[model samples]
Target: MSDWEPKIVSFLCNWCSYGAADLAGVGRMQYPSNIRVIRIPCTGRMDPKFALTALREGADAVWVSG
Candidate 1:
């Protein structure tokens, strides 16, 4: 069997969490390549349906940051 990596969907707030992500990138931090990032205007605007959809679509994990 082929090795499988977990697929992660990350929802980050534009003002804060997005900057952390950017810094991680700029600092050349190592992270698994399977994570997919989605930038949102704010955590207050997050919809539960988005996480549900990500799970339904076969993402192994989901992360929400503000």
Candidate 2:
């Protein structure tokens, strides 16, 4: 149980959240391995079906960042 971690599906904007995540990597910042990133052009491009698909595919949570 202690070893369990939430599996998250994150949809991030290419020039925003994704860039921050890339910068975090360069800065050696730590983020949870549970977060699975899917880069998108913009949050506006994100579809509701995407989140639903992620959930149906077994993700514990979904995050959208612009």
Candidate 3:
């Protein structure tokens, strides 16, 4: 079989997690290609539905960070 990579869905806060991700890009640091980022205004305002939806949509894992 070919290489199997996990699909990760990440919900990121616009002011925090998103910024960090951008900074990583600026620094030329590498993350796995499997990550999918969704930028939201704030983690406090994030709804449970999003994580559930990602899981249902076949994401191997979900990450939420502010």
The prediction achieving the highest lDDT against the true structure is: 2
Top candidate (TM-score): 2
What lDDT would each prediction earn against the true structure? 0.93, 0.96, 0.93
- Model 1, span 8-44: residue lDDT tens: 9999999999999899999999987988999999998
Candidate 3 lDDT over residue span 1-66, tens digit each: 378889999999999999999999999998789989999999997888989999999999999999
- Candidate 3: segments with Cα more than 4 A from true spot: none
Q: TM-scores for all candidates? A: 0.88, 0.94, 0.91
Which sections of candidate 1 miss by over 4 Å?
none
| Least accurate 10 contiguous residues by lDDT in model 3 | 1-10
Single out the weakest 10-residue window by summed lDDT for candidate 1: 1-10
Residue 26 shift from truth in candidate 3, angstroms: 0.7
